[model samples]
Target: MEKIKLLLTQYQEAILYIVFGGLTMLVNIIAFWLAFQAWHMNSSVSYLFAWFWSIFFAYLTNRTWVFHSTAHDLKTVINEIFQFLVARIATAVIGFVIFYFGVNLLKQDAQIWNIIQNIFVIISNFALSKLVIFKKKA
Candidate 1:
């Protein structure tokens, strides 16, 4: 975390966000791929498997490394966690629904839908984390 804070002065935190986001996306992709290819699960099940992994890792990384804040009390931690979960879960539901209708039902490319949803979710997650959970330093 200290190293991350030092890097923030020399590098854009967006780079860190992207790196973490990319790794977290890998978790999602692998989880979803396994659920679908191995178990032949439904789209929702595959999405949930991936989404849960992404959400958990994002929270862990953002709280411990990215924000680098140590002021969190138990109450604040719980509140931030609740908010983060709501934001990610809502995005997941929205992504799945849009993907279903736009890609699956319409027979369009699923990758396109997934990319679109990921973009939206990424922006939302950044704003929420920066503003609410791991707010900017004074």
Candidate 2:
């Protein structure tokens, strides 16, 4: 029990990130399914819908819980939000490329390709958030 607690404490940020990231992925997947499967939207359009919702959810959870951001001032807050969005946009472009290649070019399943792209997005997003957006202040 003590060992588990220690480990949890040590990796609290990563643990919380995974938890929130999973929820974000769920939001993206569900949105994509509804748009693509139910509403019969184009795969590209559906991906955009999923990306918007997931990005919104991710920003909120990452700021409040995962990174525990402390940007109190208006300027700092704006800067943080800008940086976060930029980082997400960068990763989103990568996801779109992967999705386009897998689903459009190679004729793979849209759902599977979306999931694969998202895995990459999640990993890259974590790196950006930790190393750049949410880095500890010197």
Candidate 2, residue 67: Cα displacement in angstroms equals: 0.6
Q: What is the C-alpha lDDT of each candidate?
A: 0.80, 0.92
Off by over 4 Å in 1: 1-10, 90-117, 136-138
Clashing residue pairs found in predicted model 2 = none
lDDT score at residue 56, model 1, on the 0-100 scale: 88
lDDT comparing candidate 1 with the true structure:
0.80
Tens-digit lDDT string for candidate 2 (11-127): 998899999988998999999999999999999999999989988898889989989888889999889889999998888899999999999899989999999998998889898
Write the residue-wise lDDT of candidate 1 on 1-138 in tens digits: 999888976665577788898888898898899999999999998988887887888888877777675657898788778888987777767767878887878898989988888787788778777787677556
2: Cα error in model 2, Å: 1.1
